[model samples]
Target: MTNTPQPVPASQPIPDSTAAMKSAVKWGVMGLIALAVVGALLAGLFAGKEGVYGALIGAAVGGGFILFTALGVLLTAKLPALTAGAVLLGTWLLKMILAMVVLFVLSDMDFYNKTALVLVIIMSLVVVLGAETYGVLGTKTPYVDPTPSSNVDDDE
Candidate 1:
């Protein structure tokens, strides 16, 4: 008797988008915390308590923005594909405007070192973004076939 080849599974286990987003947020937060600690330490070493406070403030602001964006993405994940893009674009624009306003307000404050705050904010943003990118790219996912298969062979 001749043996027939077994059919391969239609799809392999793939990483879920929601799960990937969650992982990214978790890692991003951790990275932000680490960056904040480092920034605080550096500030304290160079400019004492004031600098440390500035660094902490900057880290807080940056972390807030990152978390806010992440939450928006998670919330929009359930939207229809066509609408999701437009909603995400709108969310991004709003976030940018809000962040700019907050930064402008913070810049006017005299209590903290502006230089330290600005530097930490920039650095923390980079860290969080990088972490999120890494998380998304690192996840394993399977490609789906768009076309359905028919039991009958095309060739007769």
Candidate 2:
């Protein structure tokens, strides 16, 4: 029997960056939650009830930051390149200001262990950031045709 060639189907378009951002957010949030739980447990061991409260507050702050940043990324991904950059910058500035305000407000509360709060917040941020970096870097996005045929005779 003569050799027969199979038809190649057209590749579907790659999902936009917003889809990637959404995935990253999901991963980041999961990482943050896991880290927060660990941090709370450590705090409870080290400082008891006050430590637990502080740890929860810290996790909440960090989670808020992650959500805000992710929302900004998702919203800006669809804009023109230059516009997206500007919007992202603005979003970052806003995030920083809001975070500062939150910390300032939390500092005045006399109940929880401030030291534990600060420590957990910092740790949670680092963990979430690391997780997001890994998720983004590890994702296998196709920059070019992912499947290439190697039939020389078929090309003629």
**Candidate that would win on lDDT:** 1
Angstrom error of the Cα, residue 28, model 2: value is: 0.5
**How many residue pairs clash per model?**
0, 0
List per-prediction Cα lDDT, in the order shown: 0.81, 0.79
Q: What is the C-alpha RMSD, rounded to one decimal, of candidate 1?
A: 4.6
Query: TM-score, each model?
Result: 0.76, 0.76
Tens digits of per-residue lDDT for model 2, 33-117: 8977988899999999899899989888877787678778788877898998898889889889988998898778877888889
What are the runs in model 2 whose C-alpha is more than 4 Å off? 1-13, 145-156
lDDT of 2: 0.79
lDDT of 2 at 123: 84
